[model samples]
Target: MASPTPYRDENRRRLRSALVAAARDLTVAHGWPGVTMAAVAKLAGVSRQTVYNEFTDKAGLAEALARHEIEHFVDAVSTRLHEHGGDARAAAHAAVLHTLAEAARNPLIKAVLTSARGGADELLPYLTTRSELVLAAASAAIHDWAAARLTDPDPDRLALAAESVVRLTVSHIVQPSAPAERTATALAEVFTRLLG
Candidate 1:
């Protein structure tokens, strides 16, 4: 077996990061319809060939960008959870509230919502497909947190619980009638009851 080459891995990471950054910037600045392979490559400071080498087409680039965004969002939530410390339930609530608050203010998410409502087919793929991916990532994070804190580690139950938490959080983001902190507190109360 050959050893993994660090240099090649680094280059791949850099290229992928560049591509994702370019796609996001282009989509934000020019809207989803205006983002093209050529434009993304140009913004990324790489050749069109390089862009193709990394992503098959604009859709592929969008998927990659979506995954990157989801991962970043998850990382941010995880950081909030850690910052809360000790109280798992409170941490989970704080994480959800903080995440939704940030998402409410995020320009990229706003663009996606607008593009989807505007009936732009190009943007729809990113909105629908990437949404599922984000949901899955969120569920996984919640499942891990639950397993660590709860007495039972039933995978199926954990999955369901995680999905519920994500669904509720998403609902708050979609229609925030109350303050984010209050919404998060409500979610945490529900989650704690579920565990109990």
Candidate 2:
């Protein structure tokens, strides 16, 4: 058989994105337990078989949703970093503040972080226990940003700093103590000290 054309690939990507968006909406509205393959199919204007074909199973769909959201968060953080224009402390502050504020307001994130109906949330593991994607993507973004923007950076130190900041940010996102601005300020100080 011939390989798939660019057009076919683009169409598949669009369909997959639509399905993921539908799942996200359902999850935000009704939590993970309320989301069903049929519901996702209905929301996306596709058939149940199409949803199954696209995702293979519920676990696959959950993974896709988590990856998409993590990428989105990382992209936003990267943008904030770039906006600060080489001021590592400022970038860290802005990125962490934005992430914390956004997470607080995001219904999907709230669903993932909180219990669904006073029971364990199946999707929570995607953000917590099985969060390699989150850590890797966020750390890579910070590492790349620091390497480009900071002068004469030590690669090993830079990598460690990036991973440290990402882990701290994730922990804050999971269980915030103070206000976003306060937590962001403290984290920025930590990041600056780590960079030194």
Candidate 3:
């Protein structure tokens, strides 16, 4: 006999994903300051209580949304790294370029950066100042990729390189000084040098 536990868990997961998607859409359209729990619930076609159940407050929802978005970004980085195999510069260039290109075109990211210009970016901390989530996730992904591909790489140096690349990449995302291709090419040079 089926206990239905798996089905129940899947249903909960879908509901949570829908709620987050609603929050993302609202944020992209109106920025984080305009997003309300009631609005998210309405957009997701769920009760306000359901939104609160999944996320205790606005901060919780913001954290969840940031984490979800970072997951997508990191997955893209990982894919680019894998696609380039063991060539450190090529991998970094490809990964960073993909990220920069995505940020440039992604409406939600555009909204976040645009909101920051108006001094209303509630989610900027997740990507910068309060960046434990972003740094840890991105740095770990980079370190793991390097460990798997680089031969006899020093652990400490590798870790530092990973964090440095991530910080630099995030800085570029926040404020770009050059085009994606040029910036990625420069960062790739630095990445290889740091790895050595």
On TM-score, the leading prediction is 2
Candidate 1 — what's its lDDT?
0.75
Residue by residue across 112-184, what tens digits does model 2's lDDT show?
A: 7665435857887766677789889988888878878989888787777777878888888888889999999
| TM-scores for candidates 1 onward, in order | 0.84, 0.95, 0.95
| Alpha carbon lDDT of each predicted model | 0.75, 0.88, 0.90
Residue pairs in clash, model 3 = none
RMSD of 3: 2.2
Best by lDDT: 3
Q: What ordering of candidates by TM-score runs from best to worst?
A: 2, 3, 1
Comparing 2 with 3 on TM-score, the higher-scoring candidate is: 2
Flag the better candidate by lDDT, 2 or 3.
Answer: 3
lDDT of 1 by residue, 1-196 (tens): 9876999899899989988888888878867887888988888888999999888887788788778877888887777766655465787788888888887887777777677667775654543433678688887777666556556666665566567777788766655678888888888877666655
Question: How much does candidate 2 score in TM-score?
Answer: 0.95
Model 3: per-residue Cα lDDT over 89-113, one tens digit each: 9999999999999989988888888
